[model samples]
Target: MTEMRLTPLQYMERVAAHFGTAPHAVFVSTFGCQQNEADSERLCGMAHAMGYADAATEEEADLILINTCAIREHAELKVLSYLGTLKALKEKKPALLVGVCGCMPAQGHRVEQLKKSYPYVSFTLDPASLDKLPEVICTLLEGGRRRFVTGEENPPIAEGLPCARRVRHKAWVSIMYGCNNFCSYCIVPYVRGRERSRASGDILREVETLVADGCHDITLLGQNVNSYRGDCDFAALMEKIACLPGDFRLRFMTSHPKDVSDRLISVMAEHGDKIAPHFHLPLQSGSNDILARMNRRYTRERYLTTVGKLRAAMPHIALSTDIIVGFPGETEEDFNATLQVIEHVEFDMIYSFLYSPRKGTPAATMEAQVDAAARAARMERLLAVQNDIALRLATPYVDRTVRVLADARGKQEGILAGRTDTNRLVYFAAPEEMIGQFAYVKITRAEPFALRGELINPK
Candidate 1:
């Protein structure tokens, strides 16, 4: 089947003529991972193409979108609280179009909760129905069009839509969508459906355009990139991107340990710095029992083997991971095992979370749910252990010279910060002209999270 494509102004004209009005302003509040951020960019781009200018604030917006997440109960509750606050605003401005989108609204269970509990919300759209955003927005704006466009037929691969990307320098390109690994803790597979890879030609073209558009870094976003199957596999795609005509960096994330292959590591090793020296291999729980329960499909030993192979391939690779502190039926012994794994791994970064049960997941109904207070304590201990390891790992950067790509300005007084090839955040004093370029910095200070450095003339 052929896809329908439209230029930015073409859609803008269609919306303008349909509504018989001038341009509108839009405001989108996004949550969750980089994939959601990237999806929001496309949403904003679609709005702009339909003659919608981004509002400075939600109060001034003609359309307000709540691009939400449901990974944890906390994430969902945050969105719910925000929606409660917006009810008065929706009352005051009846024409103010408000809708919920992304993973939360797409869940089959959340439909009634949105419709009954938050009736002020005019409509809902899933990530898959984003291509129909103009139609949805126009209908809702016309009044008495409250509905949900979710869990419907959603094709995985979407191309050629204009985007109002949040980060100009670092482009997020989705190589594939959905997750095949039904990790018991995750709702991604249920909401996002199964894995579907985009054509390699489509991905390469997107990268080429972003580079031409002055993007200095390209981050490939996927639930599980290692499972990507197209004209090329994940490793081949990375190699092709590394070979592309550009001086920019290439990075991907959230690789399932079970699917990550030697070929992928070899490709990164061969390409070296071009493909980045950072690998985010999530080790959810160190205990073999917990791993079996979570359906992660990999034992602690297997995960360590992958880490060893990665380090062997590229010794300087800065490692990062996702960890769950208090899983269902987790004992003190299991928690200690997790800490031991963290101590042994010495990851440069850890994205830790206290597991929150999601409705319709197997683990939610599982017996022996850990106490909230216990979870908090476990979380604190896990963080303390990980923080100490991170600090030690970062210490080597001190008195070393590293190349950093300036991505943004630092929070410190007149400081500029960027990231190294190993995904290390380095802050240094530099001119604003270096915002989107590479520069060498002499590391002077090393913290658990970031490195403080001084600018050095590139060698």
Candidate 2:
């Protein structure tokens, strides 16, 4: 049987008749950042509304969609590998349909290549067009030929969309979409398009909904969260949210140092008790020349000053950072500068990656190259220094009583895991009933990755 494609409106008309009495099942495998996860929720909601049921496994799915990421070379490679596996499955189940969406499909060349190489892939859609998913799926189900819908139309927030959430207590609320900052090595600005903040009313409504659903923590997700300038802007949004009627904690991520204003810092200081005191500021490079080349728009001195200010306001702030090693034209001197910054800052955690060329970016076309061996050596040295610092920073927490919100069960029996306000992972023995509530725990042992603790008072 040939595949058919139908528009969203068309899909709605034929949904009941096409499925007959049987439910159409869909399986979504999401990869990459929290933004992708939030996008997948809407994707699933669209599928459900189109008379499709959620499948337990890919093999059981009548339709499969891979929400992919293209931030690093490895992420792209993994998507390709998954496609190969799906291709083999398609041979066995000829009626099954597969699709690719999200950041990878936003790239024209990648979409073209997928259409050419994987004829089995029924369609490709961009993240911004996800609300039109029912129409896209309808087109495929109606026996239309393989096609791509890389449309530029931004979809409105599918408010009240149904979701099969992967987590129960913690929910990711997307305050905005896309990125305006085009860092030299990044592909986000090109693929995700320019930044557009969601309306403040919409964001507040979402957070209130999550809290009502018993969600205890909300992480506002974005590429440059501090750059959010909806009607309330970032600082005002944080202040308003902190005052919401709930014992829930608020958190956000991936702040750009250049945009971390004093007003925002003051908001954090005022609501330090309600807001998680953890910041993940990406310091791509420590050398001013390297930062300039990467177009990060912030000097090492400026970054250090911001860190100093944050520490002054919140002394026990748990600082996490992102570092990129082996960027194009990075000299040994430049790499050493990063080490010096790491030493001086003493971050609690670091997400380090070797620079990978991304298509359609200025850095990709640059001529300078670091040898593979040298890059590996530099990464190993960087990790060693970071690990040593992480251990030193974690040791001081031992023997202190900290309030923790239990998130999940631990790997061992009778063990439960939770996070402190600063986002430290603490595992302690507690009953299943206490999993979603707050408890005061005494840290008995400390490790670089997690802390061992016990419930000081069980209610």
* Cα distance off (Å), candidate 1, residue 328: 1.0
Q: Which segments of model 2 are wrong by more than 4 Å?
A: 1-20, 153-160
Give the lowest summed-lDDT range of ten residues in model 1.
Answer: 1-10
Alpha-carbon runs more than 4 Å astray in model 1 = 1-12, 19-21, 141-144, 151-156
Candidate 2 lDDT score relative to the true structure: 0.85
When summed lDDT is taken over every stretch of 10 residues in candidate 2, the lowest stretch is 1-10
lDDT (tens digit, per residue) of candidate 1 on 1-459 = 113545434545567676566667889999888989989998899888777888999888888988999888788999999889888888898788888999898886787899988888888888777666776665555443687986455475657887998776888999888888888888888878888899999999999989988887899989999998989899999999989887788999879999999999999999985898899999989999999999999999999999999998898888999999789999999989888989998999999988889887889988989999999999999888878888888998999999898888899776898999889899999887788888999999999999999999742
Global lDDT of each candidate: 0.86, 0.85
TM-score of 2: 0.93
Query: Which pairs of residues clash in candidate 1, taking residues 3 or more apart in a chain or in different chains?
Result: none
The alpha-carbon lDDT assigned to residue 363 of candidate 1 equals 90
Candidate that scores best on TM-score: 1
Residue 330, model 2: lDDT of 90
Give lDDT tens digits, candidate 2, residues 277-357: 988889988999899989999999999999999999989888999999999999999999999999999998889988888
